[model samples]
Target: MAHEDASFTDISIQAASSHQVWDPFVRLFHWAIAGLFVANAFFTSPKHDLHHWIGYTIAALVGARILWGLIGTRHARFSDFLPSVSGALNQLRDMATGRRHAHIGHSPLGALMIYNLLVTLLVIAGSGWLMTTDAYWGVKWPKDLHEIAVNWAELSVAAHIVAVIVESLRLRVNLARAMITGKKDIRRDSR
Candidate 1:
């Protein structure tokens, strides 16, 4: 009995030390979307052809990501980290209580942020496209919507960055590194 207990603990420790979570497709999609958003937001002017092309590209990438979410690797799938109110509350409780529980994939709040950003980006793309059409040319709502959504997305991105840093410190996991490398190195002592 004692030997069995010790062996089980050893295996648990080893498994918790490190593991692959994000697959290559997920990592690529994440960085691509990030870079494209930065370009469209800062470098490309709306009147330029490059801006329109980047918007189209962002829309296509979002489409691909939706499909991938439906049929992708375990951690990449939507089912792996569905957003939940209870889960978020529980995480908050854990934080308040100083309880350490590191998620191998997206945390509940993280999942919510992911969904929020995806939808916001889609709105920005759709509105931008509408403004280009003959029927909606010179229309104000779509253009207004596009601007509003972009502002929301920018705020969301800032919040996401802060949350990632805070969670990484709390969990003692290098989350930004994990996204880049497709692996998370969780300490064995973490729960």
Candidate 2:
């Protein structure tokens, strides 16, 4: 009973020390994109108006995110998390060496993943939209590109989920919860 009480207190202290990371718009944008992606992929019929609207909404969200990346909060800006090959390699090295370095913002590999998903989604949306236009109507390449991009996005989402879970375990940080609550409980000793 005493041990349980001590552990609970420790957890409370850790939670209290959590730093604000994700802003409201970032969180909303993430979940909105995720939900809309799922709805369009699995629920909505391709020929339906709902599907087209969702695609447009996703494209709009991505555009807004790009603008936000230019002029948003500290962690939301593109300058804060530009994808770097060397940085990603270092992160991979850290993983291989079992060195846990928790990043306050998105890690290098995470930044790369973010860029990949953003571009892939944009491609998917663009190709999808082109399919609806008279100029690109009955175009095989756009349809092919849309299908390919969707598959890539799905794979990327799966990888992102796996990476998040692995990273949370490795760093002892609830990253998913951070996205939800806009705070990350990073340990003081970690960099």
Candidate 3:
């Protein structure tokens, strides 16, 4: 028991000595977006302040995330995970053929979804922002656009959840849990 404890301590020290992977800002932004999204879905609606507050929170979180992607830690940078169309298609092909491999960064399909999420949030935030400006107040166009953006966001989030389920089952690991903990444990050479 004593020997096992000592080995655990050594591993903890080694992990701590390793370079910090997820910056605190990135982690905070991630959880903030996730929480706000959930709150918007369940605790807010168009008829209440809760809805507006949640939306603003989500927008702020997305804005911060965009800024962070431009200049955050290595793993959190957009360059680390943005997927090309061909890459995404190839990942789909690999999935169809059971040839997908584990990766350190987002898989191609997942990366595409990440891009979609960011873009959708931007549109949503823009529309919501317009609603507050005098020039766009009560504008039907902005309302319609915001609703469309929300729909897209909802669909993308649903797809993301489904993909997470599929990946968790396929990889024998919880991807969502990794998002929360910022540590994914997979064979180093799996990909």
Against the true structure, whose lDDT is highest? 2
Tens digit per residue, CA lDDT, model 1, 75-125: 888887776777777677767877667777787778889899999999999
lDDT of 3 by residue, 1-191 (tens): 11121111111111212223456776677678877877876777676777777777787788878888888777788887765676666556656876535544566677788888888888887888788789999889998998899898898988999998997666545567667677665532243
Give the backbone clash total of model 3. 0
Put the candidates in TM-score order, highest first.
1, 2, 3
What are the TM-scores, per candidate, against the unseen true structure? Answer: 0.90, 0.89, 0.80
Clashing pairs in 1: none
Over 57-174, each residue of candidate 2 has an lDDT whose tens digit, in order, gives 9999999999999999988998878777777776787789777666777888898998999999999999999999999999899999999999999999999999999989887889
Query: Where is model 2 more than 4 Å wrong at Cα?
Result: 1-17, 188-191
**How many pairs collide in each candidate, listed in order?**
0, 0, 0
- The C-alpha stretches of model 1 lying farther than 4 A from their native spots are 1-16
Q: Provide the RMSD of all predictions against the true structure, rounded to 1 decimal.
A: 5.8, 8.1, 9.1
Question: Using lDDT as the measure, what is the rank order of every candidate, best first?
Answer: 2, 1, 3
**Worst-scoring 10-residue span by lDDT in model 3:** 5-14
Query: Candidate 1, TM-score vs. the true structure?
Result: 0.90
Instruction: State residue 53's C-alpha deviation in candidate 2, in Å.
Output: 0.3
lDDT of 3: 0.69
